[model samples]
Target chain A: MKEGNFCCHKTTERSEKEYKSLMNRLSRIEGQIRGIKGMVERNVYCTDILIQVAAVNAALNSFNKELLAEHIRNCVVRDIREGKDETIEELVVILQKLMK
Target chain B: MKEGNFCCHKTTERSEKEYKSLMNRLSRIEGQIRGIKGMVERNVYCTDILIQVAAVNAALNSFNKELLAEHIRNCVVRDIREGKDETIEELVVILQKLMK
Candidate 1:
């Protein structure tokens, strides 16, 4: 909600802890990308770089799991309880995307 | 080492479990990305989409951590024990990149 921390749209306000957690993960990922770039720049064996690439991909999956769980727990469930049936439809569409 | 699973360079051979694990994570990420794309297609709320975007980013970080740990255990450490000092330098550059 703050000026500089507009990491997400204002549809839902994340708790301070949630926002920090998300930011922390992103910062680490930025570092990882820089590391990958460095490997390429330095020509550290091609296979070596590939290994890191695979690792980064896996990290991404874990991230999705964490936030998706949080979304279901905090946002979607509450919206549905408050009689927002459209949110359920929206969630279903999202699940379809994830399962694809 | 197989023909179809050229997920990484031939620098290291992942065990069956490791390879499967990496592949599984990637498959899930592919699904997650597709889900995000679906949100865009449906014209979902911007904030909702942003939350998912943030989630994907975090997942990527986790993927990197898993693969990195495995790389150190199987590749870098082994290379060092086998008297390849260059690998140490390579790993240090990698570490510096990650810590950046």
Candidate 2:
């Protein structure tokens, strides 16, 4: 696969609306990270930049929550219904890592 | 201030090493965000992307901790020694926000 074209071994084909929403969220986060970089470059107050960083963290958390919910609602539920019980263990492991 | 040249009303001139260190961390984070965006664009598995997002969150947390410690060690300490006790309140407020 080409560099940026590399897909996961397993992929989830998100709906158009879901894909757009996720992309928009990520674009905003990318812009925020760039803004924080500019603040650092300009020697901004530590607490000020720190506040921006906190906001980015919140954004990332929200994104994760959204994606995780979709995963549970679609992927895990579908797998369990198909008798793929191993997905439960996978979900548990990832949840442990996420909650850490 | 010019478009990308805006500086904070109050600033702290970090040491050369400190400046480079902070910039490096932010650069890595910015790259990580871009990588995540690419992963999303490539329709990577939800769990894999979530794992990457968790790593980014941990990176951001480390960056905040490093900057906060420097602020406390230098800015807060200096302000207190100079009888500018209001820095304490400012520190307290930002800490509250961070903890939230």
Candidate 3:
């Protein structure tokens, strides 16, 4: 592949709507995180804090899953169609790491 | 702060050298991944494959650590300096998720 083509595949572009949605989710998560910090500072119970932490974790994981799914559908699939076997391996490694 | 300033801190810019170095490491990992696939196709021992998987995981984690460190130093620090407490919460959440 041409260097430019390779470069293009190296990064994914998000539409404005997609970007706004992601930022909105991130901002909401940010608020939850601050709440957690306030809980920490106010001597909240460990179990309660842990529960909130778990929720935050689940939220972030959900976000990451969506991003990874988009990556696979866009970048990985494009690379495969363009005859880039290396990207397949790259993606496999990425997925295994994410799973871990 | 102006919206442009906020936008600037929202993304981190990497130097060419840094970008090249990351891509090099990624490429090496990619090759290792292909090797793993070949091993799988040839019916390599499960333990052996698992070991390689662990190595790849470690490498990827290391890469992520470096990137996150840079992010904290550049984007997060700048945001904090600019009086964006929200970014602090964002980063704390990000770090907590990364740790998991």
Best by TM-score: 2
Task: Count backbone clashes in candidate 1.
Answer: 15
Tens-digit per-residue lDDT, A10-98, candidate 2: 78889899999998998999899999888888788898999999999999999999999999999999989988787899899999999
**Runs off by more than 4 Å, candidate 2:** A1-8, B2-8
Give Cα distance to truth, residue B43, candidate 3, Å: 40
What shift in Å separates residue B9 of candidate 2 from its native position after superposition? 1.6
Pick by DockQ: 2 or 3, better one: 2
Candidate 1 structure, TM-score to reference: 0.49
lDDT of 3 by residue, A1-100 (tens): 3335545323346556655555565455556656654553443433344456556556555555655666677767877899877777766766676676
lDDT of 1 by residue, B1-100 (tens): 2222544433455577866666566556556666765554444444466567666655655766777788788778888899987877877777766654
Per-model DockQ against the true two-chain complex: 0.08, 0.74, 0.02
- After TM-score superposition, the amount by which residue B81's alpha carbon in candidate 3 deviates from its true location, in angstroms, is 47
Q: In angstroms, give how far residue B34 of model 1 lies from its true place.
A: 0.7
Question: Compared with the true structure, what per-residue lDDT tens digits does model 2 show for residues B6-90?
Answer: 6437787899999999989989998998999899898898999999999999999999999999999999999999999989999
How far does residue B20 in candidate 1 sit from its true spot (Å)?
Answer: 0.8
The TM-scores of all predictions, comma-separated, are: 0.49, 0.92, 0.47
* Candidate 3 - chain A - TM: 0.85
Chain B TM-score, all predictions listed? 0.83, 0.92, 0.82
The local lDDT score (0 to 100) that residue A91 gets in candidate 2 is 98
Per-residue lDDT value at A40 in model 3: 37
Q: Name the DockQ score for candidate 3.
A: 0.02
